[model samples]
Target: YLVGGGQNHSNISGGGGQNHSNISGGGGSEPHVQGYKSQNKFLNKEILELTILLRNAESRERSLEVKYVALEAKLCQVESKYLVLLQDLKSPVCSSSEQSPAREVISRLLEDALDNTDPAEHAVFKPHPVSEYDVFGFRTVPEEDDEEEKLVAKVRALDLRSLSLTDPEVSVGVKWENYLSSTMNRDMVHCPELKALMRSGVPHVHRSKVWRWCISYHTRMFRDNLAPNYYETLLGVARDKPNPASKQIELDLLRTLPNNKHYSSPGADGIQKLRNVLLAFSWRNPDIGYCQGLNRLAAIALLYLDQEDAFWCLITIVEVFMPQDYYTKTLLGSQVDQRVFKDLLSEKLPRLHAHFDLYKVDSSLITFNWFLVLFVDSVNSDLLFKIWDAFLYEGPKIIFRFALALFKYKEEEFLKLQDSMAIFKYLRYFTITILDWRKLMSIAFVDMNPFPLRQIQNRRTFHLEKVRLELTELEAIRQTFLRERDTHTDAGPLCSDDEEDN
Candidate 1:
């Protein structure tokens, strides 16, 4: 029998009874059995706990793997964006196929017409040619020398205004017709086969048609999407923007077209229309938002175009023609253009560039408005309109050409400048005085090859790449931070629990 008490035993009395009757096995076995059962229970519990902990750790690792994979995908996407931008920067400025052969021929013809000609030939093209004979095509016969002198004196003495002058209405009509004919003839003469034709001279009567033709020509050349209802889409964009800059645009509405008598009045329909268009544009390009010089540009546009057309034209200009960043807050696009201008100065006028470097005269001092408003603020309205005509046809290159022409024209004064301030003042005010519209334009466009179309494209591309890379880096940093924060948050509880248990 087994004793259930501590340190007790029972005896087996059959064969071994004569040897010894010490039965302590029952008591010892009971305590030993109990200890073994308790140890087994503890081992089973520890194993089960370890298995659960391992499963949790594996789950956490799997989650982290998923997150890392997603982050890597995002990083790749950002890199790809930057690569595309880089590639764009490496491309050419303008494709040779942009202009048709006919356009090129027309442009060449226009250039030939404007080329150097004899004064007599130029006079022939003028509206009024001085004549030696009377208006009726009659030549008086000469008498004696003294009598001839007297006859000439008498003819000269006739009241200057009494020469059988046509009616004022008829005269005005005839003169205007002559001006129109003269302008058209000049334009046709300068026409080239591959480039857009420039409408030279004062196109007072043909302003609308000339503007429309230039716009159409560019639209075709750029293959810009001018689909039906595009204007409506633009208007819709205008209606959507409700930013603070829109208010500033409203305040400066009348001030924009200040010189235009029709739109100068406080409540004029033209002024209101211009306001609407500007405000709408402000709304449409909220990223650029509204800048100070844009109002001036829009105001100038109103002078040449109807409100609706002007709005669309401005949209085309900012979105397609000019560098995208030109109108933005940083004005980085203009800044880049200025950098290019500096490069141009260095190449074309090393002396001027050296002078500028010595004086520390940065291009930003005066070129901001030059590129932003296309010299609208500096040039006369009539001349500015003509520049705009060419601008519409050639894009921003016209502005660069115009700038180079200015530098070329004023190289003498610029070379002599003592300091940056003087250079700024000269560029700000003096350059305008020095330039003659026809002469300046002739210099700007005639055989000009300073900044080629390819270089411009490359510059734009380079800037775009830079922006993309910056954006990508910023996004990468942001994503990294976000991921770190998420990781910290996700592991916080688990770590805290582990620490407490430890």
Candidate 2:
């Protein structure tokens, strides 16, 4: 959060419209110069001291995080042991081969938790069950087959050099496993090595666990406040009581990721899981209830996580990760983000922003879904998960960083285009061709350094107010129109009667 303090201070005078001439009006030039120098020295010293304090605090935070994760890990072990003990007490004499029940059960549970499958293998297109369908489950058009083939080939060719035993990531990968055996700590992102690993990508085998860990940490407070078996409770309630959002949920189930095998068929397991999760969430958060974008979020989570895990991840994303009302009927928070993003675009990629303005194109047209669904279908699955790895770790700022990086990545090309239509077309489809996940991440995290969370929060606050006011004015206008229509309707018959009498 302190990453951008100095930069923010430099922009203070520019941001403020106050005149500086008044400061020197009463004082002589010599005194003013001396005073300025003294103040500058004091400010610099203060900044240095504050920076040191923040760094120390950050270190302490990391230590506490490690401890918290360790404790959680121990708790899990205890729970596993308790379950084993209970089983032992209830069981009769078992086979000699199953002597170490605790170890055997724990090993199986660990294996289930940490899937060792090749991530790329999941992305390979499967042959359609029927002649009309293509691999990955979507019904195929001849035109789309070429594009799908290229994406599949890119997935197959994804680099795995970072996973080698000799690589630094391998060592950090061990730390990641240990870190996740318990709860997640927000400060863990401060670790340079872990941060790099997450930014590069969580290994496919560990991705689900890491995502669960991060989300669990984020929603820890909310989870703690809820009763035990909250998800199950919510599920039961949803089954007993009809949710108003159930129809919408059912409609969206088939619409979500039809191309994926899990969601391709009407009776697919993924479709059922998606339905249950969305229904459960609608019951869980009635305020926002069910939103269209959430279906995609849950669908993506279900790709790696099971039903319960995906549900919690969706909760964290909608309730904790994003701002409130982001997916509400009005979607005020989502609209506010679009406004904030446009400002960020202007600040971070002024040329591209200017190009967008010159073409009379609102950037939000291309970016609304990007932010709404967190770029699910915009990027390939491999890269989508990579983006999400950092997103879950770092927070929403990752979205802005990646958004800016996209425009910056293709800035020159975008500028080369003559008209808005071509630009729009490129913006729409450019992300699908992003084969270099590492470069995209590097551009987001490294090149876009000091993209602080505090700044984004402030921008959101500012835009939220603006959007609220705009909504209010629109409402007022609508009210005035309604009143005028009512008055005209009431007077229309009387006017005709008076004309007939005359």
Candidate 3:
């Protein structure tokens, strides 16, 4: 959720539109100048009072959130203890002589319950459904490797002084900031100067601004939405309406960015903010409402953006950078893109692809989340920021370029690890391995290999047709199922109680 980097537009007439005539209108110039002054004073006072009330409510919300967390922990403890007691009851550990009749009755009833219950319900040891896409589902590192926390140690021990701001980078920051301001202030252009600077990386303090410019958030905000109060309006409408996707959104929010201080704990302001923005988006685009990896993308955007801006930037990615089909029930576009990536990797790096095949490693295992979340947790956070700087500038090709580049750089390590778990460890805990981000960018953008966008687009065209054909097949199957169901229903009770037909 975002939205606040003001620009001057003479027509905005009060944010310029039919939308806020009442708020911005001053009621016909000089004829009622004295009346206008009085009205302005009264309205200003009311606005000041409302602002204070809003602040107070937010403070109270913060306290309530803290209390909710404490209560939730106690609730979980009680539930766990109850489950253990239930387990003991299932085994009938205590003799009837030692306990009361009521207790014995409870135990006996519990035993009956366990006997009737599904085994899968308590099968905590059961493995997850294996997918080439799900690596975080497994415990990757071996006990010996984890004993030393070797990855953590390596990351901590590595010196990254070269990443510190240099004279040239600082100069670029100044130049980019001016570009950002001009862009925000509606001075839009195809600035080669700005795009070149963006490839280097954006400063932390100015990332939100840089991102705003990249997405043309200001332009979209005014042009497409047309309503200056668009974010606020959707927020109000969302609150009043019950969301079908609310439960899934809640679950994902709790698990997202658990280590990042901003989103570490549930019910924190950051969590609430993430929830609101995601829910608003769910409401904004019901067709693609609440996909799993979207929370990670929104969380990062929310960190850099205001509430509404985050929402719109997410839209930009899905509509512009990403194929709309990627986030839907079919996931046709994402799968096609995955195939495109795999083929491209084979085309560009035969040795690496062969190593992957030899180990029975699916390319999707590493690349899925890397692409889905735009490398949110896949790479080092600082490095992810660098990638985002380029991603927003260069478009989705940077993603493919970065993925291929990582494979190329880690070709040796990947070859050494013959097992899936070890390769998965290499992929999942990658950010923990110390990397020179500036160097990685250099390789991804320039040094490692060439990955032409036109070639990728050609692959994409073929994949899209394949997916559409699959979609057609799926729809036919669905229609066949419906016909069969209807026929079965009609054919039922051929011999009725009142009149039987032989």
Candidate 4:
């Protein structure tokens, strides 16, 4: 009976549900059918659950697709912004031909503003050739100061120069009094002649000796550490460093003092010495390493002075007058002086400044090397040396004065310049051509009283001592204070005896 029932049930399941009576013949019970129906219901419930999960997954996928599209749009916007920035970066912003109309008008106005003063009239205001050596001889003490005169006389009688050099023995009373007096008057009193000499140009022949004297006196006064070792160290550095600037220096060297018969020998000793000094200087100051116009400056120096004297003069000029950092790799000081030049132009030659501003002509483009190397490559070497003579006696102020003087001389042609490039080209060619050597030097150095000698000396000495001493003292004090503070901090707070009683 079980076998028969199994066959009948198998047949009913295999067939497409023929009849309920077929299952009854096999004794299939209502409970069995109910159980089968329950099984089918459970399978349907699982299928429904799977369908719901698939729909949820599809919804999540669609949401993710939307987010991805939004991100892609943002990426495309960023790329477009970057492309625009890149395009701008690649563009040349400062082409000279694109100068604004305001610049051209201003240039014309500046040219017109010049009084059309006769060059000869301008020359009349020019300083006569004063005796460079005795320029300050006429300086006098004020008539109103009798007591000061007596004091000065007494001080002068003490032979300060001899005493300063020899360290002479003195009576205790005198020694104490002099020390007090000197302490009160630490700065050297400049004679009237010296002041006049500083204001006027140093004659070319006397420049070398005068420069050496000035450097020696200042070195002794300031007790500069580098002064003693300077030339020797410079030579040693030159020997050690490779001749990196030789080719460039050589190229401009001959061109520097051209037309001067003194420098143009087939075997000129002066020229050779000038080359050596310049090379040595470049080696010594490797950060400046080498610049194009320095050889020209050295060559000009050699034409007027012997090699050793020329070197000393160069040392004084670099260390004392022009900005020390001007010749450095950064050329930062030149830029600063360029700004000062701009200010001078605006104040003294407003028309030129306005034209320059309108045309977008950066003063730096022309003036950077002018101030940095003191127009070594710009003007005639003879004129350059004369400029140097005045520069040494005066200070960096001569550079600005000369720059303004140059613009004043060249106002007309410069006004017609259409762009910065044209302006630079004009400066490179025409400006240097305006002044003959004598005239240029005469213009730059003669009749200028911008800086006092005492002030310049003081500035040199101050920088040498002040910053170094301050830093040293500050470090020492900081160390000691820190130690004391740390000790105090480490010691715990003291307990009161009254608290202990509690």
Candidate 5:
């Protein structure tokens, strides 16, 4: 300290010593004049350094943006020229008018220009962009929160269904059918033989028996693991004491794959089956009640198994396989999957993720419904059913495999897209185009070492721990609210709607 004229001066620094500053008593917080000047000098130096750094960053960003545009433009030009040249060589005369193939060229550009995107994303899509989805019909964008993602406003699958496969895929499917028919009657649920067969593909003829065998005999036989009386008891509750969830379940049921013959009418067996399953589940897990997406799960499960088995399949899907909060009242679980998926995308497809971020397009906006319905209307009927078979045997992580594949395959188109709606529309249009399940799954699961069971479980464990902590906090808050509520004279019934805020 230095004695002054009616003032004192001392030195103070954040660490060991002080500079020309005073930090003594009431006005000690104020820096000395000299200290202030020194700080300003230091700050000016830092500002200049930071400004230079920022300028460098901005310059680099602009340079990269230019490079990206040039790459895309060159890709598009080369891609268009190649398509035109091929068409001309194939045709008797070379002319652009006879062969108006810009769309095809664009599709080729996206797929063939492998150098334009990371190989991981590049590998997922096919060389062709043409899908039956492009030719078939209209698509209405679903509302943001609409769980019944019946986005394919119209689908004409019957005409295509009548067409013979006329390929080796049919024979392979047949081979699996004959093999399952011969050996699946055995008492044991799981075997190396069974797993190998499923990995190939379960035949439609043998699906019912195969699914039942897998669930009943193959899955764990613990009572707590089973939803034995849950279905029956819940159905009884739904029958006797009607609840609020029942109405929503009915509305969702009406919209659930409305075009599918089995579900078109309210009086149909499929609709009734869906209603019973949803209602029973609502009663079974009152906390979640009947979430919108569960209807699709039950509907598909019902298609493959009996009602009881179907209920159990959904139970396994929602409770055991999936991150639990997925279908909760608040949908807290699906959000976690988004976070995990975002990390995976960043690692697996950094370029695509950066493009999305640069355009301010959130991954969740494009991915939520995909996870919710397991690619219900996102892909064609054939793909959806096949994914379900793998999804069940493998676990919920298969959806991630499918999702990563969706982005990877469509990276070029995704990159070309500038706005959120364009990206979503592109996804809706292109994802369903690839009717070949074999090729799609090959890129997703086999081509690269996709996420393994352990990785998924680790992330899920972290999410569950987070949820547990949140619940503990929520419980404490609830207790505090109760105490606070009691202190008020006009504290109504403790079960007020406001309590949900906790």
Candidate 6:
């Protein structure tokens, strides 16, 4: 009817009829209204199409970033192999004793070359030529903090020779490099010397290779049992599927290492690589999904590993090295470790532990992240890497040693601070400002000697059961409260039935 009326009004408007001019004017505007609606629909369609295009472009860009990172890692591996060959050629053929120093000098030169090259030169994650970030790709503290500055300067000025526990006569370093280079690698049990060498520290040039070898040595069973291209397959599955952890992973990508130059910007390649590593792991282990501390593990791994290698390194750490539920929602494993840590603290550092207990200080508050992230942000990068060198080679027991060492190293200073808050605040920055890595490591290994791995395992088992029982009791209490609340709701108000009847 409206269409018919409009047609009649249109005829009247064209006939110049003054009596129906208002109707004629309304009809005359009808086409303009229709045109505007059509235009709006077209624009909406265009917007929808463009939005999809933009999303597709972003997906492609991420894919390219992952590909680029993988390729870069392969290139680095090739370069490393080539450099090893070159160094082998340069070394003099002589008696083992005479060749030792030559091999050391050659390896040192190779390390310098590898360190000097800017792998991320064309990449977005290149570190700036400034003091904002340390050589380890961690951000430096503000200059206003004189104490932090002084400590950082001390660490920077530390002679490299002082860092090594082994002397020239000790053949640990030489034997370690040889074992790492050999095809038929022996287990840590067979090569006990590697432990002493690792405790001293893996050489900077061979650190990455050493980590790969150590992780592979430990996780060989897990890695070998996997199908070919398992990591890549995980990545493909993650890319195609919408994971429950993807959103949380996205939120944490930039937050993972924002201070580091590699992850400074949102669009940095490190961010993408981190995202892929986490996302792939989430897909690989849906039960664990993505957890808070995994990012730190993966980020640090990335500094010395490529994207795929980093992903597998994470798997090795989370699934193989750590106990079950360490990164679960409850973090029950972490809590259990903390409980065990407190127990060890009391036994090892009795005075400090007694002091903490007297002050009502919960030691776990200061040390939980240390356990969760393996002291990533708690300590300076250089020392942290040294700790990791031992950690990957020695297993989680290294964490307990280091944790005890930190408190032991600062026991005197800690005893002076009577206030709990002051102690907590001080402990936070003290590890980062450690003047000497060697002293800290010594305190961990030598000072905390006879630190039995078996004891840690036994304690962990005891705490795991205790934590489970506590959680069960808490759940039962919650259920009882919920049941009572439901009963009360079902019974209604005391006066409600009578009032309704009335």
Pick by TM-score: which candidate is best?
6
> 311-330 in candidate 4: lDDT tens per residue?
66566666566666766665
Q: Write the per-residue lDDT of candidate 2 for residues 96-115, one digit (tens) a residue.
A: 44676755654443333222
Ranking by TM-score: 6, 2, 3, 5, 1, 4
TM, every model: 0.52, 0.65, 0.62, 0.45, 0.60, 0.67
Candidate 6, poorest ten consecutive residues by summed lDDT: 121-130
4 or 5: which has the higher lDDT?
Answer: 5
Descending-lDDT candidate ranking: 6, 2, 3, 5, 1, 4
Model 4 collision count: 5
Of the two candidates 4 and 6, the one with more favorable lDDT, higher being better, is 6
Give the C-alpha miss distance for residue 117 in model 1, angstroms.
41
TM-score for candidate 2:
0.65
Residue 241 displacement (Å), model 4: 6.7
lDDT of 5 by residue, 380-399 (tens): 66667777777777677788
Error of 2 at 410 (Å): 1.0
Predicted candidate 3: what Cα RMSD to the true structure? 21.7
The list of candidate 6 runs beyond 4 A from truth reads 1-130, 141-190, 493-502
lDDT of 3 by residue, 429-448 (tens): 75545356766777787864
Candidate 6 collision pairs = none
Q: Put down candidate 1 lDDT per residue, 1-502, tens digits, no spaces.
A: 1122111222221323323322343334544555556546655666687788989999999788667655654543443343333334322322345555644543333333223244454422221112333321222212245532432322321212122121132344455466446777455222442133342433445556656555555454433656666556766766675567767777777666454554557876567766677777776677876777777676666656787667767776788787777788767677677767766667867887788788888765777678887886566444567677677766788887877777777788888888777787787776535424656767777735655888877866776667667768999999999999899888765456668999
Stretches off by above 4 angstroms in model 5 are 1-167, 181-185, 188-192, 217-230, 418-421, 463-502
| Cα lDDT for residue 190, candidate 5 | 56
Q: In terms of TM-score, which candidate is stronger, 3 or 6?
A: 6
Q: Flag the better candidate by lDDT, 1 or 2.
A: 2
